[model samples]
Target chain A: MNSAETALFGLPWWQAFVGGICTIAIFSFLYKENPFYRFFEHLYIGIATGIGVMATINTFLWPTVLKPMVGADRIPFPDGTYAEPYNEFYLLYLIPIAFGSLYYFILSRKHNWLAQLVIGFTLGYGGGLAFKATFNEMLPQLEDSFRPLYVAQQGAQSGIDWLATLSNLVFLFTLLTALSYFFFTFRRSEGGPAEKSALAGRWMMMGCFGAFFGATIMARMALLVERLEFLINKWFPLFFA
Target chain B: MDSSARQKDSLAERLERIDRRVVYLLIALALSLPIIFGWKLPPAEMETADSFFRVVDELQPQQGKIVLIASDWGPGTQAENKPQTMIAMEHLMRKRIPFALISITPYAAPFLESMPRDIKEKLEAETPGETWNYGTDWINFGYRPGLIIMIQGLAKASDLHEVLKTDVSGTPLADLSIMDGVHTIRDISMLMEFTGLVSAFNYWVQFFQADGYRPPFVHGCTSITIPEAYIYYVSKQIVGLYEGVAGAAWYETLLTKKYPGRESGTALKINTSLAVAHVVIIALMILGNIGFLVRRGDS
Candidate 1:
């Protein structure tokens, strides 16, 4: 027997058995939908929700908000002054807490407006940030689009650098055509300049989608390979020998 | 009567109506057999991975400055993101650079705790006498639920120690020797986001800057997000990018080259399986296309 097999890293031996069962249940859908898959799916959602709720309370709420308001975070000095990172104004936290709690008003038929109040406020806040962030995020990209058509040789070089200049030309072509595609007013039947550009734009968009599809396939395959490895190396070994 | 009634099925008709279960079984075999047997392909060197390694290698551990890792991956992308995060974090640890892990997604909380500790244990064991104690080496800032608001707020705050007052545990950030020098957004040396979420990357690019002090940004994206991630890279928003498990394998390759005899990671092994799976899928696609053409001709 291998030394590694003798001990399971403090995890009970049943842990792997359960993990194996859950994995098989999920994969059972590949053959046909079954009750095992449905049961495990529900179990997964319940467990994930439970973990998320517990983590939020343990890590954020209890420590950040509740501890301060209730003075659980306070450590007293020898002389009785507060030694902890706390303030008397923590009681004001109830205002935001009360406001956030309005989210549960979504359950109330008549009082759903209370939930809308918080939602609207949050949307406005997000919209304002998005406006500022959009400019910050995009301006540099816009600036980058102004690629130099001509590459000057520097440091003892004499002629144009073909590779970099070729790349720039490709970028310029791609950008103009891709952006021209959004000219919604131009009709494809007209066969005008906009039509030609828009056609080119459509091709570029298709190319982008194809690339995305290809990468998605690779990513999904990686996941499948990993799970297979887990099943082979960890799970299957339990039955053998 | 039997001979007339039982006309032989054409290859096109048979191929066109392949049972999905059969295809699934083929895929299962293609993915599994390589791992069960000992088949592997060496990871290819990639320019993206090279650049990713370079930026990390160029970094000097400065007092009051630490690398901020946006560990934004969860269970869905653990296949790609886990290895990517491990390699990058391993690099940072090997360099003896102090780093902090922060996650905006609730799903990312378990990873923030487990991954770093795992790396610390591995690194410490492999290299004797190297201490990777928490707080001194790295800190976990746990899960922050508010995504963009939290980021922008952190950027605008004058004092990070005040805003981000505590570690994952309830322990005060001020008590951590690492946080002594780190006070503002400007104190960060670099930002490395490992995530599959496109919006997570966008938030950092858009808002993680103040006073024109934008730290050099890099990313490790799941394979699916690589195309979008490349746009950021080309735009110069992201200084370096390593794409998926293949990219992680490439980074590990760089490490193996730099420091010979370093115990290799499983990225290459997983990537080999991925490559084989790709070949099987592509071959099936070709066969399926041929079947469609033949059936169309028959019709």
Candidate 2:
């Protein structure tokens, strides 16, 4: 094996095995609670946090900060390509990073004001963003929902067919009834029409929930199967070999 | 008999219904046997899958400066995301598409390292003449912690090379040949995100589209996430979407169809497991209902 492969395997065997074992151990917490699982759980988070901070600095802050200010236009490469001329706007990100760090200052009465500048800008951007995206996403869906219960393809009797219309009508009812079920203020109104509609709405909502639940369970099962494959196919087979 | 003995008897009966371990064993058998035998199922194309393929196919790889791949999943989700990552990279490779990867999650770094290398080696071994080079053809930006802020930074920044200085290899991004034509998010012709979380895609749609710059966006997301993710597909927020292993298998089918003799057994194996799991789960649900009805009748 080359140095790279050696380097990968060079990590203490115990450490590698423990790391792999710890993953399964932590997963076993889903079945029951134990200290071993909890210990690894905290360790994983702590290690991940440290690594994350290091990567952020190495990948973002350093190149975006120290390299541009101090390091020259040429840095060594595997292919020996020189660094391009530095741009200044990269440094402006430091302001947000600095402001974001002040969130920890909430404990102190004096330095806490610094946090709001960051929070306020975030809130403002988030609000503007939500307003814009909400319209962009929802408006189109709303427009598409008004389809005339059937579609027609060229030179075909496919347009406004009964089955197509029936399905579309069912879809429309499900959509509206599910929406109406969430109407809390009109719950007390007991007209025959309203009550009948509300009961239908409740059943429609249940169907929606069931479909949602089934889809969710399937997805979770897929994820589980994926993990099991990795453990058996990638990890265990190698270990045995 | 005492009340407690009666309770114990009832609990034992419930336990005797069927050993849960037996269920686990059945699931294991279902997933493993087909995979071991290299079984391939017939493709059942979904519109979302079709749309995903169409978007990827339509990208003018040579014209597009760089394909931006958001690899936001970690090893915990390697089961699904690994194949998704491989298939995407393979597609990009076949098209001579030079791509750069960015990760918004912390756990993504290790998987990012392993995934590209695995694909590169596989491409080399399977098609010797079709050598896919690393550091030149493809680059990984590794993992950045602040997802929303980092993506926004990328969106606004005019020069990504100058902004995020280094590739995943620790080579300066400026030094990499792949960054030559790419500068901003706008310069990207296509963006493909393979994520374990639905919210990451939601974040992409919200933040990226809010800036009034929407590229032909495609997603490879987890199966559980597809329903919510499909809503975006319906709304046209994303151009196309792939759902979990089935999605990965569908993508694999497309890839092998376009570029024959590529190493693609992975997707098929995963999909077989899925089909069996579906059958097993349906059976369990029916049995569970039967048990409930039988108990009600007895009472």
TM-scores of chain A in all candidate models: 0.87, 0.75
Q: Write the per-residue lDDT of candidate 1 for residues B26-117, one digit (tens) a residue.
A: 88888887788868788888888889999999998888899999998888788899889888899998898999999987889989999889
Candidate 1 chain B least-lDDT 10 residues: B1-10
Candidate 2 residues lying further than 4 Å off, grouped into runs, are: A1-16, A69-101, A109-118, A155-164, A238-240, B1-22, B25-29, B32-43, B156-166, B169-175, B184-186, B210-213
Model 1 Cα lDDT, one tens digit per residue, A60-122: 788888988989888888997886665779999999999999999999999999999999999
lDDT of 1 at B298: 50
Could you tell me which 10 consecutive residues in candidate 1 chain A have the lowest summed lDDT? A5-14
Per prediction, the TM-score for chain B is: 0.94, 0.88
Give each prediction's DockQ, rounded to 2 decimals: 0.72, 0.43
Model 1 global lDDT (CA atoms, 0 to 1): 0.86
Candidate number with greatest lDDT? 1
Error of 2 at B131 (Å): 2.3
Interface RMSD over true interface Cα atoms for each candidate = 1.2, 2.6
